[model samples]
Target chain A: MTMARRLRTKDLSAGYDSRVILKDISLEVPAGRITAIVGGNASGKSTLLRTLARILKPKGGSVLLDDNVIHDMPSNAVARIMGLLPQSPIAPEGITVADLVGRGRHPHHGLFSRWNAADDRAVTDALTATGIAGLAERDLDTLSGGQRQRAWIAMALAQQTDLLLLDEPTTFLDVAHQIDVLDLLVDMNLSRRTTVVMVLHDLNLAVRYADHLIAVAQGGIHCQGTPADVLTEATVKTVFGLDCRIVTDPVSGTSTMVPIGRHKSGSVGQEAQSRK
Target chain B: MTLIIDTQAAAPASHARNRGTRRAVIVLNMLGLCLVGLIALTLSCGQGCLPPAHVLAALTGADAGGADFVVNDLRLPRALMSLVVGLCFGLGGAAFQVMLRNPLASPDIIGISAGAGAAAVFAIVVLSLEGWAVSAVAVSAGLGIATLIWGLSSGRGAAGARLILVGIGVSAMLNSVTSYLLLDAPAWDRAEAMRWLTGSMNGAQLVQVWPVVAALAVFGGLLAVSARDLDLLRLGDDAARALGVRSDATRFRVTLAAVGLVAFATSAAGPVAFVAFLSGPIAARLTRGGRFILPAAGLIGAILVLAGDYAGQFMLPARLPVGVVTGAIGAPFLLLLIVKANRNGGTL
Candidate 1:
């Protein structure tokens, strides 16, 4: 049987208890493309990501994974087709990197199935892919922030799903580490044709990395399309309330945003050009 | 860069060695401690007058004289009861610790055992009951208390910390009731009440051992099967769900099995101090990895009870009961863990 690669949400309304964070949101993640959801804080981007990942129950409408209603499907069946990494993934104390990664293979085995060589190889390959093979035996708590994030990504990768969702995967990293994480995600997309949906706080990074940009505002999609079309200066002002100049990145030829503050409207673009 | 490359090359080799050695150490410790505990039980059996050799002979049914009567009628039943009670406490405690993600969340501390204690005390002091009747009441009370705690803490997103808080409050209230009953009891009932209050394994009959064995076979098997789900739970709710774990259902079933195990254990042996509280952390420490180690904790719990009973019998000059000895040792450790947990701001 052929598996469906498309993930779409239909007018989904969800929240914690009575407070609805995401309202009447409809979105379809382009198959085999990197989709980045960007918005201000409390703009429902994370909630939308979580709802799409099936971690949060939608009060209205449904998330359709390849045409099947996700809420009706068994979670293990959904898990086999998709994976999610939360904003901050926690590792139980003293868990080795390899052991943590191996847990990702949960959907493949039943209650009594022994851990076979295929599971072992998948874990090893995930560790190697995330460049944490050397840290396989190291305790998770002992790793640096970037390495730890990679380990978590490795776990998601070991799921070997067609679609992967991440909420702020690079929130706590340094600039270099942020680029490293984005590059890894790009590599995963390019090499494996994995549909990646992520919420990113950095507008420029989102434009640079995402094949499709979803600008969220007021608990709804403000703009959605290719970065060049969706992330214009006016949309940035409307979505983030930040007046900004849009320019093409010298290296990636993607749209980049430069914020024009109250006093430095004309100098921002010059500064960015000089830095390049 | 050079150092990074070199260390990376050598890490997996040392890591493999480290894992192998740690595993070997855990196995050796479990086996060795069990042997020591069994030997201690045998030695403590002959404390009245007979020698250790005579106790051993009696145990084997070789010396079917006075030694046989003491060993079979008194020592053997007590020892077997201790073992079974310890297993139940260990498995139940380990399950709570893993499920709640806190070492301090044992059935003893969380009032499940206290419910059993309160009921048993009520039966013995107020109703003038003894033996199986008290045991039956204790078991039912334990289940009731667990249900109460679950009901109280089953709010939206009622995670480990909230459950622990509710449990602690319920336990404290139940403890007060138990104390009041003990104080109001007649002088004749005070001795039995005191033994029960402090968790004694004295005068353990063959009948007490059977119910616990049966409980362990049922509840212990359930807990063992659900062990993986408990491990998944430690990764927090969202991650567990993402990995296809039905968190709510798994939590419910595991809690029921664990509560049953603790209730049976408490009815069989008294609350028995902190065997449930201490076993999981002790097993985790001994194993030295992040594995849950439920079976290892169970073995450790069994060994601790047997050893604690033996220590109470022979180590102290006054010959205190098993519960008193365990309480004395475990209370300080509990305090230490509380302080450590607060300092780390990890889990309660």
Candidate 2:
């Protein structure tokens, strides 16, 4: 792809039939950069992504891709420019990795065009991109969680879109796998300048990897900016409703958040000894 | 990057593998066709008393003495009915299985076939209707029942399991009504009602084949056109939509086509028990892959009906209806599936 396209929401309001989950949300996604959306449970982070991807119809307002209303564009046309990886997508029984990834080429072909060399190359490139080329013949059910996640990312990558939206892509993975996924996204951004938007729960990782961070709370954007500007202690308190200390990570030179709870005022052992 | 080079290098191997999978699918389909042909030949051989050479001669349009009427007139329509009805049921069943993402969600299990049966039996035993009137009512009733199930299951993105559970409950209730109508039926009408109840190919007319042919053409064409989207639906609604498959529209079209297929078949063949339920899993097992084998399943269904009728005619001491034999065979498989699904804890 050439220069990544811009995705923006204009006064967007959406929800499940008659109940609004996101309200009056207006934002512009920076082209060709990594952005992470962080929020508490049911904070409409995923819903926002779904609406922007045109999976859910917005009750009011619209999402735009390069000034065209995304909802108004043909779905396949939108798909050519943007791709989404949802939370916990199902794999059909007995599907091979190659077959599963090949489905991602669906939007590229016309109704009667058979799968040709180009489609095969795209699928293979996806498998190679995700480092699962050797496992192409393996069944999806047989892969480990991290490997499965990588395979799904490969499927999205096969679309070869300029923009990608992922919802909690690292939810079930171990710590190392989480970092592996983030690192892979960063690599894609650097190599292809693909615009990346993701919903993540790991605050420190978000700070380390995201060029822009969006904090959502109460059906609106609570904060949006670079991590250093958006991860301040006051903003964290407003967004998460938790008291927390913000410090710089010595290794990555990025902001890290340490939350304080009601029970622990100091070191636990010291507090117990003083009470005794 | 090296990823591009590695992908290019591995392309030929993966290309060969793709060809291999396609070959397996084609071979399985060819095998199904051969089985259907074999069963058709067996069905036309006339009580096993006629020699195969005589039957072959008759089939080749040569004069075969007295066996002409038995082979061409009586056996041909019934056997052709089995094939057509089987295709409808099999295609509809596999479509349901793929779209609903559940193996057990066949039209028969989900009450669409029963809806047609109930209406047809009611027309026969109570309203005193027959032929095309009965078929029309049956089709409408089947669509009505599918609509009802669709309504009940449409509760804010309820999953496939919910629709199936509701369908099982609804089918059980409709079956009771059918049984009651059979009991209260006049003695003369009881036999016809009973045939519809168990589902049979007995006395099927050559004229009756056209509706099913028409339905299969229209709906089968629709299915072929939407096969790619239907396959993408296996990834679930969100992912399918993300892939630009109009998920809701594709699902609606597939469901409509599937319901139309089974309804037309049921009106013609009296709901031929379990052909729809068995063909999808059987085809999947035969093909041994994840791709939807609509045509293969249709062929398997034809084989099942033809073979079932043959077994009913010759295997037992007293002749039985095709429906009875299929039911007898299918109930055991259904039981096996239930036991397996129970063991697997809700995968079915």
Best candidate (score: lDDT): 2
* Candidate that would win on TM-score: 2
Q: Model 2 Cα displacement at A89 (Å)?
A: 0.5
Per-candidate interface DockQ score: 0.46, 0.58
Clashing pairs in 2: none
For model 1, what is the C-alpha lDDT against the true structure? 0.82
Per-residue CA lDDT of model 1 for B1-348, tens digit only, reads 999986665455335435745784666476557756585555445567567777778778795567788777888888888888888888898888877778877899989989988888788778988766876788788878877887888864355667788989999899888889888876845446656677778778898788889889998888877777778878888888899888888887788788888877776677889999988888777665455468778888888888888888878887778888888889999999989888885542
Residue by residue across A82-197, what tens digits does model 1's lDDT show? 99999876677677777788789998878899776677667766787788987888878899999999999998988888999999999999999999999999988888888999
Query: B70-90 in candidate 2: lDDT tens per residue?
Result: 776778778888888988999
User: Interface RMSD (Å) of model 1?
Assistant: 3.8
Local error of candidate 2 at residue B115 (angstroms): 0.4
